[model samples]
Target chain A: AQSVTQPDIHITVSEGASLELRCNYSYGATPYLFWYVQSPGQGLQLLLKYFSGDTLVQGIKGFEAEFKRSQSSFNLRKPSVHWSDAAEYFCAVGARLEGSQGNLIFGKGTKLSVKP
Target chain B: SQTIHQWPATLVQPVGSPLSLECTVEGTSNPNLYWYRQAAGRGLQLLFYSVGIGQISSEVPQNLSASRPQDRQFILSSKKLLLSDSGFYLCAWSSRVHEQYFGPGTRLTVT
Candidate 1:
């Protein structure tokens, strides 16, 4: 079965410190990978997506994720953490077939906490 | 640019009452729509999806049902609400590329 795993349930990082969140996926095919961030009580916002071509994809809010096919991982990283970046992050994977319905499998999510 | 809208940004309902949440997309046509629920400290779970009018696919077997009466509209309904249904409900839309755009979400509290 296809699934996404975000090993870290929560992570704490001081403001201005570099951050990295790990994600691993089990998929049968070349999958479409995505990262989304959700603020408390708010909807999810797309952080970045990896469809094809480049292994490293840049997203909004100064976040970037790299797709490592061999490791079956797409880890999100940022050079410096901001206090506002304290949110839950999710990793998702979906089929890459053309015209396929957007049925994505998401990980349990990792909550990031930024310390002052 | 495509935009997704989900409303009654917040809902507080008694258990055993009926429930209805609406979602609509603008600037796109015949897009794939999805309903997902995010419980406390958990990731989003896919509930339902629609590829077109009157075409609905359920991913989970639960008390919820979904309808797509129109191309751009999707509704999630339950004949009776359950306390387990209290969570953040999100509506999303996606095109051929399959990257979904989510709405502001509805926070449902079952009391």
Candidate 2:
């Protein structure tokens, strides 16, 4: 079965420090990958997505992700962390339903804490 | 751009009470809709999805059901609420592409 894994349950980073959140996925076909961030009591916001083409995709809020097919990974990275960047991040793999629009299978999520 | 909306930001109900959560999408046409629930400290679980009006597919067998009476309107319902049903419910919409736009979400608490 296709699934997504966010290995880190929580990560803490200092302000202005580089950040990386790991994600791995298992799927039979070329996968559609995505990253989303959620603040407390708020809806999730899309960060980035990878369907085809370039392995490196840049998203909103100074976030970027690299899709490594060989490793079955799509890891999110940020050059510098901000206090406001603290939130829960989720990784999802899209799977088609009856050849129609696909559904997202999400990982358990990784919580990022930024310390000033 | 398209936007999704979910009503009753927070709800509190007694056990065995029925549930009705509404979701709607604006500035889009013929979009696909989905219903998801997130339990405390858990990942999002897909409950149901609809590709078109009156076409619903359930991903999990639970006490909840969903309906898409119109192109952009989706509803999640339950005849009897369970204590386990307390969670955050989110509604989302997407086009042919896989990227989905989520609504503000509704927090349901079944006491």
Candidate 3:
């Protein structure tokens, strides 16, 4: 079965420090990977996605993710952490449903804490 | 541009009360709609999806049910709410492409 795993349940980072959230996926074929961020009591916002032709994809809020096919990983990274960046991040992989429709399989998520 | 909207930003009801959550999309046509629930301290779980009007596919067997009466409208319903149903409900829409856009989400609290 196709699945996504976010190894870190919680991570703490100091302000202005670099941050990386690890994600690994298990799928049978070429996979579609995505990163999403969610604030408390709010909906998820798409961070970035890797479809094709690009190993590295840049997303909103100065976030970027690199899709490593060999490792079956798509990790999200930010150059410098901001206090407002403290939130939960989720990793998901697209899977085919009926016909051409598709759905996402999400990981448990990693909670990030930014320290001042 | 496409946008999804989920109503009743927050809901609170008794365990036996009937439940209804509505979602609608704008600026898109014949799009695929999905319903997902995010439990406390957990990731999003796919509940149901609709490829078109009156065509609903359930990903999990639970107390919840979904219907797509129109192309851009989807509804999640339950005959009776469960305490375990207390969580954030999200609605999303996607095109032929795999990427999906989410709504503001509705927080459901079943007491």
**DockQ in order:** 0.80, 0.81, 0.79
True contacts kept of each: 0.72, 0.70, 0.72
Give lDDT for model 1. 0.93
- What is the lDDT ranking, best to worst? 2, 1, 3
B1-111 in candidate 2: lDDT tens per residue? Answer: 778899999999999999999999999999989999998678999999999999999999999999999899999999999999999999999988989889999999999
| Colliding residue pairs in candidate 1 | none
User: lDDT tens digits, residues B11-85, model 1?
Assistant: 999999999999999999889999999888777889999888999999999999999999999999999999999
Alpha-carbon lDDT, every model: 0.93, 0.94, 0.92
How many clashes does each candidate structure show, in the order listed?
0, 0, 0
Better lDDT candidate (1, 3): 1
**lDDT of model 3, residue A111:** 98
Q: Give TM-score values for chain A, per-prediction.
A: 0.97, 0.96, 0.95
The collision pairs in model 3 are none
Model 2 lDDT, residue B49, Cα: 94
TM-score of 1: 0.97
RMSD after Cα superposition, model 3:
1.3
- RMSD for all candidates, in order, please: 1.0, 1.2, 1.3
- For candidate 1, write residues A7-111 as lDDT tens digits: 999999999999999999998887999999988888888999998999999999999999999999999999999999999999999897776787888999999
